[model samples]
Target: MIPELAPAKACAAKVLIADDEPNIVVSLEFMMKREGFEVLVARDGRAALEAIRREHPRLVLLDATMPGMSGFDVCEAVRADADVRSTCIVMLTAKGRETDMARGVGAGADAYVTKPFSTRDLVQQVKDMLAKDTAARALATGSAGAGELPKDMPA
Candidate 1:
């Protein structure tokens, strides 16, 4: 009889929620945790940048108008820093104007989500962005087969 092998497990992805609004933070935390992410939280921009540098989360949900540095500032800083420049940033803010979106993108945000957004959609978007980012990184590093299971592994 063949022995049953345990399935391989991937590390849980880290996601940082950087927002000032308590309600939004709570909800985002809940949703991300439910989706099996290791969630981190920062209530202001300065703290957000600190966490990004220290923890190195795979993605950041940032707020534009925070108490100190501001999401744009944090994003720009992240892009300028070589260590964390590949970190994904998604701006979640009340500022929904065209210029605000443009500024967020210019500052290196991968996506911009406005206030009163649907949590379900946000979760889906996050998943898609993370997957795309991972694929891109794998390709850049010449690991295009990174996601493939080994030949000895059962399907």
Candidate 2:
């Protein structure tokens, strides 16, 4: 009989989404939950920071502009934190300017996505970031068990 490959282990990852826009947060949270991710929502940058500090999510999706702190500030703050410095950060904004993208990168974001993003694309990006983060953590811990996919959301 031919040898069979083992299935890859599913990893549970938590993601925090920070966006002032209610619609955006709702839509994203729904999609992320559907994809088996534990999600936390923050309506503003300051709240995002607090959540990150308290929850230490595996990934952060930050809106570029918010009522306070801004995405840049949140990214900076997270990066400066020793506890969660390695968390993956993706910036989402309506402005797609090169300078804006640069600013996000300079502020320590792992990815930048435009506001009018395709739901498919956003979900894919989230998966990619979480996978990358899991790999990195696995390397650091020297264990395959980095964290199961999160529980499914209610129908």
Candidate 2 lDDT, 1-155, residue by residue in tens: 99999965555577899999999999999998888888999998899999999998888999999997899999999999999888899999997999999999999999999979997899888887676666666678776643533221111
Instruction: Please list the residue runs of candidate 2 whose C-alpha ends up more than 4 Å from where it truly belongs after superposition.
Output: 1-11, 145-155
Stretches of candidate 1 off by over 4 Å are 1-5, 146-155
Alpha-carbon RMSD of each model: 3.9, 6.3
lDDT of 1: 0.90
